[model samples]
Target chain A: MEGFLNQLPIGLSIGAVLLLIALGLTFTFGQMGVINMAHGEFIMAGAYTAFLLQDWAGRSAVLVALPVAFVVAGLMGLLLERSVVRFFYGRPLDTLLLTWGVSLVLQQLARDLFGAPNVQVLSPEWLQGAVGPLPYNRLFIMVLAVGSVVAIWAYMNRSAQGRRMQAVMQNRQLAATSGINTGRVDQRTFFIGSGLAGIAGVGLTLIGPVGPTLGTYYIVDAFLVVVAGGLGQLRGAVIAAVALGLLNSYAEFWTNASLAKVIVFAVIIAFLQFRPQGLFVLRSRALT
Target chain B: MLSVDGLEAGYGRARVLFGVSLAVTEGQLVCVMGRNGVGKTTLLNTIMGVLPATGGTVTFEGRDVTRLKPHERVKLGMGYVPQGHETFPQLSVLGNLLVTLEASGNPQSALDDALEVFPRLKPLLKRRAGFLSGGQQQQLAIARALVTKPKLLILDEPTEGIQPSIILEIEEAIERLHASGIAVLLVEQYLDLALRLADRYVILDAGQVVHAGTAADLQGEEARRLLAV
Candidate 1:
């Protein structure tokens, strides 16, 4: 029981990070059907943004990097969407290959600017100690993750812009007929989705090192979370994130980390065979 | 209010509309009729700017809009309700209406005018649009377009796949719209609805305008001859 309680925070923090990353993937891959393999690079961009801010602001760098990372990553996403991704809208394979190439180029750029080795980011003085059983850094991450989910939920459900995004997500042609600037919507969606990934990258520095390959580390798991959760279903992404986090934490506790991952992937493969459309498949006349 | 002169459009190499020219004067309800796969939808799509015209000019209110994007045409008060009742299934009926309002740059205004026409949608505003019956969805689609305050409303098969009872409701709505002097371009499969609502008729056979006349003049034999599969 004591051990289980100890693992809870770690599991929850993992879930939070996964949720943060997966929410963006949910929009990019789930909603738009764009196979964005370069999503991790956006996350890396966020982490490096933090790294640069830490160099300048020292202890307050993480705080400053939050918004800046979003902009930096969002602009990168905007450029990617405009220059490359927009042309490959209906072609998933080409998008996959092109984005993969983009990711490689981004990775090389990062190595050139920063270095191949992982760099450490220092936690603020306030984050040094634990509050009860929870470390302040992990708690901060959990709060950021929860806040992201709430903010996204409200934006998607309450805002007029969100309604337009939903319309485009369901049926682009119908939305266009209704006078929606679907191209503009797609641009904004990609920006916001990439911005969220940047924020996720900001959260990532709390637990790990920042490096050229930082994005590559989480990219596969993020995709797994999105696939396990259903495409375009935010609720499904949340549920899948939590489930995967818990499963990984518990499995890792019992066995080796690599083996635990193998188990998680195996379980996901099995799960998909039964519920092919993921956990919360949206039913719509357009989809049919 | 709208005129197409020598308009040409198609899906890539296979041209679907060949020199299809017609006009909808102010306050006129023009019904376009044809059998399945006879370019009925392609024509509507081309007019709405959802599908680009490959050749010729579409003048709306005397301004050429042959090359305008779909949203731009919509901003110019050209409203469209597509073939399938394409409501945002996950959205509440109110949300669907709000989207139109957002596009038109006045999202906060009450949908009094729209709701007045489709009063049945007032109570069902909070319900997901996909959950509504096909008839209700059709009403919502029209209501959604109405919120944009369009000068010319284009409908593609408003009564398709709907039951007879609700068909009357839709027919009544169209009549009311006509009574209000809104220019309507209707693409319909039902001969009775078209005959009841249209002042003028244009029949297309294999993407060409084969017959054109007033509703009274274009009768049984002519319609069968033009609309035959």
Candidate 2:
């Protein structure tokens, strides 16, 4: 019973991490339909931002690195969108290959810059304690995830810019005719999406090692959450993340981690077979 | 206020508009009439800058805007409501109107004005646009464009597939809009409606203008012959 109770927070924290990583994909992959295989690298960029900031901010580097990493990763995403992704719009296979190649180059660049070995990110003294089974670090992650979700909700629902983004996502031609600069909106969406990955990377430095290939560890899980959640459906992603998190926690507890992964993949595949559109589908009148 | 000189456009080697040229004076309501598959929609798209023009120039308010983007042309006082009663389906009726009003930097009163023009949308403001009936969606689409405070409004088949009652309402709205002195370029299949609202008419056939004349000419046998089947 105690073991089961302990896994609840663990599962929730895992879900929070999943939510953070997949949030960006909800925009880039879900809305734009651009298979950005290089998204993992943007998360890597965020992690590295924390690592580099450690020299300057010491134990509180992770705190300062959140917004900084967002800009860094956002700029990288914008550069990618402007230089390559824009041309390959509507050609999923081409973008997949192109972004995969970009991801490889980025991974290699990270290996060269930061060395092959993993680096440590020291937690703040304030985050040293625990509340029952939930460590303060894990609790911080959950709070961050909630905060991000709320911020994104406000941005998407309340702000003018966010409304324009939704307009473009729903109907590109109508949005253009309505006086919205769709290209500029696309650029902003990419920036924000990649920035969320950076924020996720900052949150991740709390629980794991910061390394060149760290993003590879969570990329598949992130994609799974987004796919199961549904495209451009925020509530769906939140629900899917939590459910998968709980499932993963209990599965790993019962068996080994490798078996747990296999079980999760099997479950997702089965779930997709039943509901291919996902937990929630966006309704739109736009053709293609 | 708008003029197209020798405009040409195509979709991947399948040319649609071949040297189509026409002009609209300020506040003039011109209707383009044609049979099915005559590239009426293609001409509006090219003029709106949604599709790249293969050749020729488009001038608006004495400036060449041939290479401008769709949004740029819109910002320069052109409004377009594409065919099929399009709206942001996931958004509320109010959200649909706000999307355009916000983008064009129009004040809140503009939205009120649009709602006033289509009073049928007032009761349905909070509802999701996708859930609305086809007629309601069409009204919402036109209301959305009107919120932008456009100098010219371009409509493609606004009355297509709509019920007679809603079509009558739309016709009244168009007449009202024309009375307000906003230049209109309308593509309509219905000859009676076209003649009723238009100050001038242009007939297109196989991607080219077969006839162009005053509204009186639209009543003649030649215009009817070109538009038939």
Candidate 3:
């Protein structure tokens, strides 16, 4: 029990970053029906930005870099969607190849800019330490991750623009007929989704050293959370991430971290084999 | 209130509507009827600006709106309800109503006029549209158009998949909408309900108008021969 509790914070912090990464991926994957293999690169770009900014302006610059990362990543996503992604909205396999190429290009760009060596970033003084009732318990990074989940969920469900996006996600043609500007919705959704990923990258820099391939480490786990939750479901991402966090944490108590992934992957693969749609699908006609 | 003349449109290289022409007078109920693949829905889509007219002049309220966008047409007093009961599944019934109203330059608070057409939707406003039955969704869809308070209300296949009782309710709503001095352009297979409510009828076949006359003339053998009903 002590070992399990000891491992909880570590697993949860990683899962927190995973949740943010997956949230953005789910928007394009689940709603628009695209598998952007290069999405991890957006995270990498944001992490690199955070690293550079932390060095230039001090650790307190995270607050400023966080939003800047969102803009930079979102603009990259916006341009990508308007130019390349517009053609690949319905073509999943093509999207896979295109985004994969994009990811490679982004990683190379980061390597050239930040150098081959991994860069380190520190969280601000207040945001550096542990949170919650127990000392050395929950990580501050995990708290920001948890807060990001809440913020994203609220943005998706509460805001008028979010409703418009959800409306488009639910029924694109119907939304168009109802006078929703579907093109604008698509562009904005891509920006928001990618921007969240950028924020995830900045979050990653908080936990460890930032590098060009930092995004690659978390991409596989992000996909698992997104798929398990059923794509585009904001709440599903958080729930799945938290549950997977606990599962991985407990497993890592006895099993090695690498074996823990095998266990999680096997379970997720088995899950999808049974429920092809996902654990919490919104598109199913269960209501009507 | 709407005039479409010499309209030619199609899916791609193949032409479906061969210079079709039609008119809906002020405050009159006009129904367009045709067999499957007869360009009934296509004409509506072109009229609503969802489908661009390949060659045609669409003038609404004396404005040449052939080039206007779909949302722009809605602003010029044109409301469209597609053949299927299409509504945003994620949005609540109220949200659907508000979205339509917002587009039409109104809001949910100004829905007294729409409520008169579909009082049933008032109670179920909070429910997600995905949860509604086919009939309820249809009612909500029509109400969405009504909230626009358009000069011309265009509904394609408004009665399909609806129960008999609900069809009757829709018929009553249409009659009321017409009586309130709003123009109605309807497409339907329920010939009896259509003929009873609509003042004029146009039968189309293979993308051309086969017959056009008052609905009162539906009694003759020509009606059956032309409609294939």
Candidate 4:
């Protein structure tokens, strides 16, 4: 019982991390249908931002890095969209291959710039202590996750720019006819998606080592969360991420770490075989 | 206010429109009539800049707009309602209208203006557009376009697949819009409805404008014969 109780916060923190990484995928993959393999790199970029800011801001670098990393990663996403992804719209296979190539190039660039070894980011003094089973850093991640979700929900539901983004996502042609610049909306969508990845990277720094290939470790898992949750469905992602996080925690406790991943994959595959559309399906009448 | 000179467009390598030409004078209602697969929708899309014109020029308000994007064309005072009563199904009826109004920099009063024209949409404003009946969705679609306060409204078969009562309502709305002096470019398969609304008419066949004249000329046998599949 004590072990089970201990795993609860751990599972929730894991879920929070998964949600942060997959949140952006819900937009780029779900709405735009672009398989951005380099999303992991954006997370790496965010972690690096936090690492770099440590020199200037010291202990509070993590907090300052959040917004800065968002802009840095957002600009990178915007550049990628304008330079490559725009030409590959509606061609999913091409985008997948193109982004995969871009991801490899980014990994090499990181290796050259930061060297091939992993670097550590020091947690703030405020986040160094623990309360019972939950550490302050882990609790911070949960709070950050909830805060990000709320911010995103408000942006999507309340703001005018978000409405245009949703409009463009639902039906591009109709949105264009409605006097929305679809191309500009696409740029904004990519920027936000990549920005979210950056924020996730900052959150990850509290729990683990920051490295160039750090994105690779979480990228597949992030994809799993988004795909299992459903495309463009925010609620679905939250539920899936939490569910998978708990499942991983329990499974690893029962068996081992590698077996936990296998268990999760098996469950997702089986679940998908039954509900192929995932947890929720977007109802739309737009003809491709 | 809008003129197309030798407009050509196609899907990939398969050309659908070939040297199609038509003109709409200020506040004039022009009906484009044709049989199935005659490029009527393609013409409207090309003119709206949803589809690129392969070879030709489109001038709107005396400005060459052939190279402009679809949204740019819309911002230049052109509104389009594509076939199939398209709406953001996930959005509420109010959301459908607000998206356009906000994009076009129109005030909230524009929503009231559109709702005034289609009063049925007032109560349904909070409902999801997808959940509305086909007729209701069509009204919402038109109301969505009207929120833009367009100078030229291009409709591609607005009455298609709708019930008789809603059809009458749409017809009345189009009539009111025309009476209000908004130039309309309507594509309709129903000859009677076309004749009722059109000030001038053009018939397309196999990607070309085979016949063009006043609505009176459409009363002759040649227009019907050309339109008959």
lDDT of 2 at A263: 95
**Number of the top DockQ candidate:** 4
Model 3 segments beyond 4 Å from truth?
A: A127-138, A248-253, A256-258, A283-288, B5-19, B49-69
Tens-digit lDDT string for candidate 3 (A1-288): 666666777778777888888888988887788787777888888887787787688976677788999998899889889989888887989998898888888888888887878988777777644444323313655777778778877877777777777877887765666666778888988898889888888877776788888878878778888888887887778878877877776777778888987888888889889987676877634234
Whole-model lDDT per candidate: 0.88, 0.91, 0.82, 0.91
Predicted complex 3: CAPRI docking category: acceptable
Ranking by TM-score: 4, 2, 1, 3
iRMSD in angstroms, per model = 1.4, 1.9, 2.7, 1.9
Residue B80 of candidate 2: its Cα lDDT? Answer: 93
Interface RMSD of 3: 2.7
Native-vs-model 1 lDDT?
0.88
Give me the candidate number with maximum TM-score. Answer: 4
User: What TM-scores result for chain A when each predicted structure is judged separately against the true chain A?
Assistant: 0.97, 0.97, 0.91, 0.96
The TM-score obtained by model 1 is 0.96
Candidate 3 versus the native: TM-score? Answer: 0.90
Least well predicted 10-residue stretch by lDDT in candidate 4 chain B: B128-137
Q: Deviation in angstroms for A44 in model 3?
A: 1.5
**DockQ metric for all predictions:** 0.69, 0.71, 0.44, 0.72
> Per-residue lDDT tens digits of candidate 2, residues B1-229?
9999999999989999999999999999999999999999999999999899999999999989999999999889998999999999888999999989989988999999999999999999899988888899999989999988889999999999999999999999999999999999999999999989999999999999999999998889999899888
- If scored against the real structure, what TM-score would every candidate get? 0.96, 0.97, 0.90, 0.98
Cα lDDT of model 2 by residue, A201-249, tens digit: 8888898898888888888888899999998889999999999999998
Whole-model lDDT, model 3: 0.82
Give the CAPRI class of candidate 4: medium
Candidate 1's docking class is medium
